[model samples]
Target: MSPTRSHDGLDIGVSFEFFPPKTEKMEETLWASIKRLAPLSPRFVSVTYGAGGSTRERTHNTVARMLRETPLKPAAHLTCVDASREEVDDVISDYWMIGVRHIVALRGDPANGVGQRYQPHPEGYASTPELIEGIRKIGDFEVSVSAYPEKHPESPDVVADIELLKRKVDAGATRAITQFFFDNDVFERYVERVRKAGIDIPIVPGLVPVVNFSQTAQFARRAGASVPAWIVKRFEGLEDDVETRKLVAAAVAAEQAFDLVDRGFRDFHFYTMNRADLVFAICHLLGLRAKPEEVAKATAAA
Candidate 1:
């Protein structure tokens, strides 16, 4: 992908992903980060469901709170792992009743954990496409499904991955958020392939600001994302330097976002890891700012 110098006065769309907090202190931190990023007016924010639907209640509570207390649209993540159809349908109904119109449907990892073979419950929706269809039947939800630019770990090839995405789109998924990747060319090529396969939904690239390089690298390996050699070199010798690591993280993320923008991508999804500092810095670099007027209006409404 050749980068273009078209950085002057561009408006872009962004969405954020957050995981439900597991404790009171983490809850406080999550809320603080949400309040900070809320002012920038993301297109939508999503809260993740834990593996095997373990954090179902926590995820629901977080989404409900966002709906009630903030002026932001929240997308609840629903997974088809160890859940019966009726149970998952009930969750979908509950979200609909609470005014949630968007859902991120996923085929969650095996209940045993990552790297384990995923076995769908006997009475559950077997895949993400089935989950999307179930949500549509429950209500008119704007569903989003997962995409893997480098191909899902379990997928045999890119063709199989795109076929799955096509099924989800046909089942009513309107958007696909990809797994985070370090290489822009890989994403660009994936986008082209998705389009050529007749899947027209938005394939938003997911960006992760490396809060902890080692941890992020581990996650990348598990999720089938490649960690470019250059990224490893960038974080080299900063093992104990917290402040400088953060600075490098912000710079690297900013460069990636800007390069994607130059390639004509106007929408992005950020995996925030429940923190806002690095994401906020990258958003600023992408020309997104918190409009004071909008903030004041939201505050007054609250």
Candidate 2:
């Protein structure tokens, strides 16, 4: 039996992603989510770098605070967009200095925002693979890069996306957290293609529990992932009913996660839109219960 099955659902690993807060109220909410999820013992909790690196300072501060206040390991997202090589390297070295050893490196969306064309700074790391190389050069950071199960919007084909992933792994990425997809079949097929290409690093399936169906559809569209019709139907009548919607959203996300566990996926990464209740409930449904911090970390690392 696979380790995922043998573990009796207790030994699987999970991680979370949070974006830095922009306000005091948001900061309160963000820390609430962090503290709530901390007990589940995620392998690492990652904070996102906003498009074009707009949230660089906030990301750093949140990560630094996590390092100072929480026992949870934090991974800082680094991007090559508007910043030059020296600027980016200085940030990487700062992370190392602060004892953050995991980096999620990416070529961020265009500086202006989504839908804008991306142009690399002439003096910066030109691509994600190159950014990974720069990060590796600076420290023995455990670098993680993005993977797209539905294929990156900019890639001509899925094969090309896998080829770029191959380059990222060759450039020293230690893991790939996939862009969220609604369909498990899509993720399974993407993993097959990745392995066939000889990319053996962990391809963790990223899960986004729906806080709102319409909003989730928007995110999926931007990510080039399709929301299946059945998922659409599940939420069609719940728009005006917030309570029902939350319940249904929890059910849908839990079902997806449980199915993946059945399929032998041992690791999961959740995009926790700064909300913990939904993701926490889903994890609880998956046989995960909060333990003392040390035991939780040992279970996660198991």
Candidate 3:
């Protein structure tokens, strides 16, 4: 049997993504989500960086706090958008100094917003590949890069996107977490193409638990991903019906994941959007479980 096929024939590894919160309430909520999901023993959790270093301080603080507070390994996102080489390196060094060994390096989208043209800082790393090389030069940080299974919007073709990923791997990226897609076939084909091109880094499929139709649609637009019409129809008319939406969201996401697992995908990275309920539910469906005592603690707190 393939390594991905388990005794129960279900692929098992999972990870999560989180963004630094902007307020006290948001911070509390974020920690709650973290505490709830931590019991699942994710491979590692990532903290996202803001545009143009807007949340640089917040990202740093959140990551540092996570390092000090939890057993969960934290991966900090670093981008070559507005910071100079010296500035970016200083940030990387700070992460290393603080014992954060994993980094998600990217040539971030334009700070103005997606669809706006992206221009690297005149004195900074020019692309994700360059950023990966810089990260490797600075330290032995295990780096992750962004992959768009459907093709990045900036790239004229999927081939271009795959070539860029090849360069990222060649430049020392340890893994590539894809931009989320609704269809599992997209990921399977993308992985096949990556392997065919001789790139061997793990390409983890990014899973976004659909929490809200409007919000997910907006995010998908910003991230250069397509939301299929079928997905839209599935969530239709549940706008105010929160409970039903949650149920449907969980089912949709779980089914997508199950298909991937059946196809031999072993690792998944969830973009939780700092919401616990749906992600937790999907993880449960995938056979994730917290220790009894841990569940009791969370339940008592709840």
What's the best-to-worst order under TM-score?
1, 2, 3
Candidate 3 lDDT over residue span 93-133, tens digit each: 99999999999998888978878998888998888888888
Report the error of model 3 at residue 134, Å.
Answer: 1.0
Candidate 1 lDDT (Cα, 0 to 1): 0.90
lDDT of 2: 0.89
Give the clash count for each candidate: 0, 0, 0
Tens digit of lDDT per residue, candidate 2, span 1-302?
11122225357778999999999999989988887888777789999986444488999999998888777789999999898999999999999999999999999888887887789999999999999999989999999999999999888999999999999999999999999998999999999999999999999999998888898899889989999999999999899999999999999999999899889897889999999999989888887767675445434432
Over 4 Å off, model 2 = 1-10, 51-54, 293-302
What TM-score, computed on C-alpha atoms, does each candidate reach? 0.95, 0.94, 0.93
Q: Model 3 scores what on Cα lDDT?
A: 0.87
Q: Candidate 3: which pairs clash?
A: none
Model 1 is weakest, by summed lDDT over 10 consecutive residues, at 1-10
* Model 2 TM-score (2 dp): 0.94
lDDT winner between 1 and 3, please give it. Answer: 1
Give the clashing residue pairs of candidate 1, or none: none
**Each model's RMSD to truth, in Å?**
3.6, 3.7, 3.1
